[model samples]
Target: MLWEALGAARDLGRVHDIAAVLIRYGFGDLVQRLGMARALERAGKVLHLRGQDDIARLEPAARVRRALEELGPTFVKLGQILATRADLFPPDWIAEFGKLQDAAPAVPFEAIRAQLAEDLGDLPENIFAELDTTPLAAASLAQVHRARLADGTPVALKVRRPGIRPVIEADLRLLARLAEIVEAEAPDLRRYRPREVVRQFAHSLRRELDFSAEGRNAERIAASFADQPEIVVPRIHWQWSGERLNVQDFIEGVPGRAVAALPEGFDRRLLARRGARAVLKMVLEDGFFHADPHQGNVFYLPDNRLAFIDFGMVGRLPEARRYEVAELLHGLVDRDGGLVTQVLLGWSDAAEADSESLRADIDRFVDEYHGVPLKQLDFGAMLGDVVGILREHGLALPPDLALMIKAFITLEGLGRQLDPDFDIAGEAAPYLREVILAHHAPDAIAKRGWRGLVSVADLLAGLPHDLARLLRIARRGSLKLEVDVPPLKAFGDQLDRAASRLTMGIVTAALIVGSSIALTVNRSDSVSLIGLLGFVGAMLGGLWVLVSVWRGGR
Candidate 1:
């Protein structure tokens, strides 16, 4: 574990900082429970705990969001990831997490130019014709600047912030340890799956830090839409791209957020429809999509085309998962509660839940949306309601699915922003139908049947050997069976502790009895002194036993 003594020593300063933030946010109890307080004290670190009561007056969710913000980029990104977990948190918590923004003050141009020069193997002037010192945008990990190539092609240069890797790495290390502590010590927070969340976030953040990976993601998405002239991804200038630097064609169009600034002839409704269809195709048809499609990541070009940028975050759905999603969406539209319930249960990787209760809830939800016009229906709200039900039933969507849902919600919101009457349900209908039809086609069934047959045949071929091995193990008396029953194991641990305490009590009593007899038979001062020492030792041992019992009682 990263929180082991050796590893924690290396990160003692970071631990102190994190604990200080938590305490300042009125989470000192959490800090103590996680053993951070004890560890910090052992390292001789003083924690400032003043002003906590004032911060405690704020709502818990708000306090957590503020703490994350203060903790810097890694935690802000974590909060953003948490914002997508509708099935793990209630609406209030999710809303608070959504408030986290990635904006940060830009690193100075002089420092950036030094890194850029090293990355480019020469000065910035030697590569690009002109590079602007002013940053176009600055974010938590990187900043973008406008530049022009030698041939006069305009481009945007995305440069990783100098010395960011070490800071983020330290934060990630502390986060890993913190997640472990929360999982082991805070049973109430265990349902949130802190370890799994941190693991996913770490993987995602690392991939995002690699500018080359973002370039590759952009190319892949661009290739996916090569035949469609309406959707555009910036052409990657890989000659200058690397782990720390990305160069791509600059998009010179109306920013997606500036709806009022669109050229006089641009059609908002058409743009909305096209954007929705493009995202649906990526998700349902291509099985890969942009995880974040917010206004900042999109631009509007002439002829009503859309330009999507920033491939830092994306989602991929396997073939099986794509089909399941299609089924779920089809069921929702058709008001088939049973189908929806089945798809949901299949997605839940937890222990069996109350299927009948879940089915009833799904039916009620479906009925609530029944007869609603497609144009008037709120698809995002519907998805949120479904996720709320899953939350109530103690089920959470897998990480990929959670990202997909968040993307869908963002897409719908963007659509409505462009056109007041935009209908995501109507726009998604055709793509969903195609996916469902493709899954049930005759060729698809035959392909699945052939795969299943191969699996069964392999199993049959290996059956005799497996049985022979099992028989041999049994004959040698080496067979083993293991059962994991948490309650019984817990009771056994308690028994072990109680037995140890009882043994200590018996030893203490024996010392007291022997010492009392020695005191009565003492003929010299030394014997009496020895007897007195024995009595003192007995008293200390008795106190230990009493304290152990008292603590165990709680």
Candidate 2:
């Protein structure tokens, strides 16, 4: 580990040099914040000093943006993620990070040729009828060169830069270690879990490095969107693709953002709607999304179809959670804060349940903001408030959920940029309504009921054995059995509590029915006493069951 750390440190020095270029280009603030403040200060001692005012005059956000650009692709990608995490970082940092693009200095043709040969086991000439020596586009991870197969099929050859993986791996290891150290030393840092963040970054970067993975992702996304002709995903050329290199059918279209510069034929409004709808469907309906939907990854094809590129990062939600998400969104749309709180609490772990506090917070949040429409609500602000409440109550969301939230916000922001009037809430209404209807459909209710009945039957079937064991233990000189008696006892306690709850429900229903009957019958006010007593009894019984169940859990 020490040797690895030292090697990583050396790699870190190289990264620092790259970062220094960014810092020199007016991104000193971002460079410093990327865990290089001390190094930057040291460099400053050797390279003359600039006062704080001078640094501020350079514009902190622009400085950070330049630094990310200087640092190369991996850091640029990191900056994109940082841009979305408005809750974690300041607004200025988020704004600055958003400007950081993944454009990188292109490797020389010789280096690209060497990498292609190493990956494909041949020179470009042998594998292709023609290969463009000039790159179509150069990015941090890989550069694309337009080429054609021997069969005369036009393709794009994406060749990874020579020896890029080692640099990325080394930097990731250093970052992971740094995270561990920070988590150990700073309690606040522990909340973010530096190691986990690095791990996620490593996973994302690793996928990007392996062109085969990107190809697979593209294929899967293509399959998901097959029914939607307006959306296009470039077909991967599996025959010539390898882990380090990717070959795909070359997409001939301008970027979606660049459509503004194109001829008047393109329908910008329709294009924007198509892009937003495609992304929304991926996130809400399909539950599998192309994580990066920036302008560069989106293209406007002929016939006004929207094409998506780059599948390095994707998000998926489990089917159950996806259903819950549908419900949560529906609740949001309906302005039912209680339902939203319930769904959120259900998604949380048992350890996080502080019923009193959670209920109070939900009540407050609902009272404060329930009537506001989705268009009027700032999703980020709402999320921040909820996160703040959860933090105060010592609750934390699972990492995947947090990532999903980040993805959702990113999608929203991207959609807004494309179409300022794009109403995500309105667009999602039909989809969410379908989900809710499915959830509450008669068939669904019957299915749930049948499942519940089966569970009850299973418990009843076990009751005989349980009772026999109890009797046998009572008959024996020593009470002994292989059963996990504690859980069984808890279950019995729960059953008793349930019985108490049922009795309360019955009594409450009777009271309501009797009161209505009395009102209709023109009975005197004194005649309502029986209903009141029944109501009180029901309340006491319900409270008793709650206390019993709570104690049993303890």
RMSD of each: 3.2, 24.0
Per-residue lDDT for 8-30 in model 1, tens only?
Answer: 46667778888899988988877
What lDDT would candidate 1 get against the real structure? 0.89
User: What Cα-based lDDT does every candidate model obtain?
Assistant: 0.89, 0.70
* Per-residue lDDT over 1-554 for candidate 2, one digit per residue giving the tens place of the 0 to 100 score: 22334443455466556555655666554444444544433344232223345555777577667666766667787787666554356566767887776767777788777778877777778999998888888888888888988998898888888888877876676567667656654665555556776787778888889989999989998998888898989898787788988898888788756645766677666776677678767776777888767667887887888888888778777656777888777665665767877876775554436776787786777568766766666554566566556655555555456666666665566566656665667776777777667778899899989999999999999999999988887898567557554446647866887787777667666766776676567666676775566567656756776776664453
Write down the TM-score of every candidate.
Answer: 0.90, 0.66
Over all chains combined, what TM-score does candidate 1 have?
A: 0.90
Lowest summed lDDT across 10 adjacent residues in model 2 is found at 42-51
